[model samples]
Target: MATTPSSAMRSLDRAFDVLGVLEDTRQPLRLSEVARRAELHVATAQRILNVLIERGYAAKEETGYVAGPAAVATAHAFLVNNRLSQVALPVLQELAATTSLTASLYVRVGHFRVLIARVQGRNPLRYQLPIGEKLPLYLGAGKALAAWLPDAELHSLIEQSAPFTRVSGEHVTAEDLAADLDQVRKAGYALSLSERAVNVTAVSAPIRHAEDVLGALSIAGPSSELTETDHTRLIGEVCRAADAIAARCP
Candidate 1:
């Protein structure tokens, strides 16, 4: 019998969910684990996995199941075709080299920020968000892009993640988030020290095109390195690099 449209759509959604779980975990997973994470029945997940394996979107391994070459190829295709990533690579390299800090580019997706490109610094930090990872928009460099969002969206994100604690052991409230966003608007950049991770410090500026905000450009490194560096100078470098990337983009 031929498949119905609604059933096909449901199957597609399940497949996507399984794919997301595999990619997000970044590790091999047992079939039961995949089913639990995808919120599907074991049999349903196995069926989806079989299709994915045959299509080279996933592979069955000795340990478990892992994302296959096709997933990587798809991410590569997006990066190669993405104008923002293409335009920002050289600038990210320059910013990382000049500032001696890791430089990254982030694009907002709903309530999350996704790292699209990054250049490692001379000194690596203990914590790093790899390319293609999605993180809450209220974290560190994410606030730079989030600052320009409309009030409703911005407030919603703050409410979701506020009343939280930083990796440095500081508590954050909604009011604190509102105040910080105001500061970001006033300064045209965001500065966070040990906000997301205990030893990480980040400075970020918005990348804008005309009146539209595109994303963010950020430099992050170990907090200890900043004790001797001028915060204002680092902020300036980040903002300049962000502006350069914005100007170069169409």
Candidate 2:
């Protein structure tokens, strides 16, 4: 019998999952290790690996398997075709000019968010996130992404974001996160101050296509700059910029 469409899609998903595992580790992995991390049986993994190897998306090393030239080409294609960066570039520049604070666009990667575009602030002492910087979804400006994630994924990210030992007593409970996300969804923006980096403050708003979130736009600066009056003004600016980006997107 021929494989059903759903079964083929499942296999495809497993194959992609194996690639993701390898990419995240940034090193060659044995078939058993890939299977364990990807939650696939060794045979299933080997089958996927065969296809990946044949396609030049993965290659076997003396150690194990690593992403091959095709994977780099795929990533390059992704960068070249990035709609968000295209839409966000000019908007980010305008936002930086308007706010006199650093503006950035962050896209959610699995288990993290990556800084893809940025415009520097006028101030010399501003908080800046360079392009390609990756950050956890639980802290600072990433609350915008965290707020809109599905419940199960949010919980999974929350667990991945923090370690068991919270010597600083900063462990966040599901209840607290739930409340925080509620406010973010309600207000259509996220504000985090001194949570991840002490003495830094960020205001972030989601960029969306109707209800589907594309990413987030954020303004970051020293905590001292976020006074009551500044908070009201900056949040509005961030929201407007985010809306503009969303309007430009699909």
lDDT scores for all predictions? 0.89, 0.83
Poorly placed runs, candidate 1 (over 4 Å)? 1-4, 124-129, 150-152, 227-229
Clashing pairs in 2: none
In order of appearance, the predictions have TM-scores of 0.85, 0.76
Decoy 1 TM-score against native: 0.85
Worst 10 residues of 1 by lDDT: 223-232
Candidate RMSDs in Å, in order, are: 2.7, 3.8
Clashes of each: 0, 0
Which pairs clash inside model 1?
none
* Candidate 2 TM-score to native: 0.76
lDDT of 1 at 211: 90
Error of 2 at 225 (Å): 6.7
lDDT by residue for model 1 over 149-246, one digit each (tens)? 99898888888878888878888899998898889988899999888778788999999999998899989888877864567889989999999989
